[model samples]
Target: MSVTGERLKALREARGWTQEEVARRLNVSRAAVGHWERGKNEPSYDTLIRLARLYNTSTAYLIGETDDPSPLSAAQGRKRPRSVPPAGWGRLTDRQKEYVRRVTDEMREIMVKELLDGEQ
Candidate 1:
């Protein structure tokens, strides 16, 4: 595969995103991602920039000029929380957990309805 194709595949896999997921983020079809990875075609310059931004890397790194492609290199080798919880929410009792779950579900439904209605 070409350097561009190899780098694209590596970056996408590093982020644990499937081709379809990457395609959705880039507003392209999964086939386009597959083709790019397979070197059947190349993305335009604008798409290349979009890919780098989405993957949090530089365009030069995406094209395989540098091994350390991550834009977060400054924070590299530092320990960080696996998953940070929202502020103001400590560990919850069983009752509180249930209540929060219900409220979250209700809010999700309301937001989804609003979004779908707006689309129509």
Candidate 2:
């Protein structure tokens, strides 16, 4: 099975949930969950996002893109390399750099929106 399938099964088992229970929570059929666990199929991006949220994990972790289970939200204030690595940015991978960039962008957007709203 794929890493995603393995992780999904492990997460479900860890929660002591039956396939039916997981399916119910995900608003999918039991067979769909089974398929996901068996690596017969993968969830759509939205469904994957839902799964990550439901499991309290990150989409990257669920998809085997990263081993970190903590979601991006967990790093809500970690938009800078200085925050992520007090030492420096040299330790960051390309993927981590990209993640920092994305977080910074999101934070900037939110700050702009809030500032504009306060002006009203």
Candidate 3:
């Protein structure tokens, strides 16, 4: 089995869940779960996030990007994955969003400076 498929199956089995059960919980088809576990297809980005959350693991781990199983929340104070915007972002005012963008840019600059300093 592929790394992702193996990981997915292991996580679900570790939870003592059937593929059908996982499908029901994720609001997807049982065949979809089967496809994932069999490595026939991959889940979409949003579905991948939901799957990671459901399995209580990180997408990086699930996708073989990292061995770390730590959730994104464990990286507190770290910038969130750009694909997943901050909560309630859509509800924010345009001016508030702009302010947030500026803050994020400032934080990125600070992080870059810190990394450079550490290297020196």
Cα lDDT of model 1 by residue, 1-120, tens digit: 756789899889988999999999999999999998987886766687689779887654555434567652322432224265333337544644454445435534654676678789
Considering every candidate listed, which one attains the maximal TM-score?
A: 2
- By TM-score, is 2 or 3 better? 2
What are the TM-scores, per candidate, against the unseen true structure?
Answer: 0.56, 0.63, 0.61
Using TM-score as the measure, name the better of candidate 1 and candidate 3: 3
Clashes by residue pair, model 1: none
- The TM-score, computed over Cα atoms with residue i paired to residue i, of candidate 1 is 0.56
Ranking by TM-score: 2, 3, 1
Candidate 3 local Cα displacement, residue 20, angstroms: 0.5
Model 2, residue 13: distance off in Å is 0.4
Sort the candidates on lDDT, descending order.
3, 2, 1
After superposition, which runs of candidate 3 have C-alpha atoms over 4 Å from their true positions? Answer: 74-120
Tens-digit lDDT track for model 2 on 1-120? 866799999999999999999999988999999999998987765677789889998765776655677766533643444355423347665855575455445546755786678789
